[model samples]
Target: MAGQSLGTILGRAFRLRCPKCGGGRMFSGLLRMHDRCSECGLVYERDPGYFLGSSYVNYGFTALTLTPAYVTLHYAFGWTNTQLAFPLVGWVLVFPVFFFRYARALWLGMDVYFDPQSFEDPAESEQPEPPVR
Candidate 1:
């Protein structure tokens, strides 16, 4: 965060790349994230339930999107609640699933940005992997 801009942070996050190095991918698949960065070995989940905060990011974005869409469709388009219910409900269900990875990535990026010290280069002091649950 010292020299990295917001754009760079979001760019790396959106691309699902490692926050520190921007070289390693954060996820190996649609829903599976690597334990550590391949390029820099930065541990992705710093502690237990680390990604739980990402749910806030997901919910916040969903509300922001939903509120405006609901308002616009209801007022401007004169769409009734019934007309909007199905699509909006569907969106509420699916959008979070689709945005799951992104929300986690954004949360990680913001966390790294705000607490750079917490995410220091792992090469300096290797961290033991957490025991498999």
Candidate 2:
């Protein structure tokens, strides 16, 4: 594809860009996307209703980052869930927040990367008007 496409989007996810634009952030905070990006004016809140594509990306991220920790506990030191409780819990504790950010970022990346219009297209998109207009 002339556009960056999915795999590249995931790589950009690691870098934390708007996967589509690759020029703005994928997050504005722990659980929020700024209504738009400060740099690109990409409207994150713009009806990303089909963000489910990134659900697996976020889940895979969880599996990749956490599974190894569990494996290390089991193989390196023969730790059971009881023994690995603290470390496992500590790792698992961040799951929701991490996944939220991960999902949003990954989704944005996919949209923007494959469809630049996911970032914005001048002619087809409209600017929000002032209350008077």
Candidate 3:
């Protein structure tokens, strides 16, 4: 698959099942990854260099998902900015460590399912695709 189906993609974003086959579990636990998909032979490690992007993803997900929650909690609980932000921001700051491993695994799986050339056999690198007529 060039990419997983929409349901699978959402599941991936939610850190759910394997995106390709959509049935097997992707993570060994909350943040640990299986070396390969039980359903498809998708290797969990797409590139050792890939996870460098995990920081940015972790930050983005944090901002998108948590910022509104932070604001809402402040209003709902009658929390002063300092009162709310202190502990909440501290929690937000720590969220990345807990999230990074899953995010790194996500980046790897994304490269696998979404990268056009990802699943192609590296041994055939010298071969060319048939030219369109």
Candidate 4:
């Protein structure tokens, strides 16, 4: 794990593999994720709503990549906003769906990189309980 580089982790993310082992698959279906990694037994979801982070990833990716293209086409190419609107809207809606798995994978990879302890065995690590209010 220490020997792995950022590129390696990102590559694994692009491949949709388990961020830790880079062997087990990250998803079971289009939007369904395997509960844990098959190779390393890493849990995909640390808590309920964990995937909310991935939604932000998906949104940021879509906005960052598409916004520039839209601006370029509209201003430089002289395409009308009406012409760009449909395709841009469709892209914003559709691309996120396609990118869902990758976003989650990337999010997981980022988390694993920043929080190395997340890669620890679940049995060995103690899960923090929610505060009782």
Candidate 5:
């Protein structure tokens, strides 16, 4: 299959579809993801520590989004740090959980976009070479 555009990949990621096929469902449940894409059979986990990168995405996204809101509320509305503590803590805790799937999906999609070979069929890539004899 030809490569998809960045927009298409991001769209698939946001929708939680397989980044390769964009048709198969990415997750079987809220936190449980399938081993591979149902439609294209592309493996989701590239390595044991693959999904750890998604935690960075989650943290960066939370910080980038919430920092603006926090600064605005603190300066413009004169909200005290104590007053915002509970809500900020709750948002920090909850947003990561809510965004977990998407963060992982987006991370995978971005990786696939940059490293196209990673998404190729394993069977195709694993063919044995002919003997030199």
Candidate 6:
């Protein structure tokens, strides 16, 4: 398959589809992900710590949004820090869970976009098996 555009990659990330095929689902349930893409057989976690980088995506998003929200609510709306505490804490706790799938998807999408050739079928890249006796 040809290399995908940025829009295509982001679209697949948002839809939680496999970055390689864009057809196989990234998650089977709310928090359950398939080991690999069913359509393309592309492994979701390339290494033991592959998805660990996804935490940066999640944390980056939360911090970027939370800071702005806190500033706006505290200054523009004259909300007290105590008043904002409960909701912001809830957001911190909840949003990551909700965004988990998208974060992983985005991580995978970025990897595929930057290294498209790495995702090609292993069988195609490897030589034929040796004949049996």
Best by TM-score: 6
Q: Compared with the true structure, what per-residue lDDT tens digits does model 3 show for residues 1-133?
A: 3445555565664665665566667677766777777886767666676568877888887888687877787777677887776777787888887887667756655665566366655664556879999
lDDT of 4 by residue, 64-91 (tens): 9798989899999999999999999999
Candidate 1: clashing pairs of residues: none
Q: Model 3 segments beyond 4 Å from truth? A: 12-15, 73-78, 120-133
Q: State the lDDT of candidate 1 residue by residue for 94-119, as single tens digits.
A: 99999999999999999888887677
What overall lDDT goes with each candidate model?
0.90, 0.69, 0.68, 0.89, 0.91, 0.92
Estimated TM-score per prediction? Answer: 0.88, 0.64, 0.65, 0.86, 0.88, 0.88
Candidate 5 error regions (>4 Å): 122-133
- Name the lDDT of candidate 2: 0.69
lDDT of 2 by residue, 1-133 (tens): 2467577788877776766556777666666566766675666656556666667777777778888988987999788888888877777677856677767777667666667654556655776877985
Per-residue lDDT tens digits for candidate 5, residues 20-110, read: 9899998999999999899988889978988999999999999987899799989999999999999999999999999999999999999
Local error of candidate 6 at residue 121 (angstroms): 2.6
lDDT of 6 by residue, 1-133 (tens): 5789999999999999998888999999999999989987889999999999999999999998899999999999999999999999999999999999999999999999999888877666787889999
Count of clashes, each model: 0, 3, 0, 0, 0, 0
- State the number of backbone clashes in model 4: 0
Candidate 3 residue pairs in clash (backbone atoms < 3 Å):
none
Error of 2 at 113 (Å): 3.8
Cand. 4 Cα-lDDT: 0.89
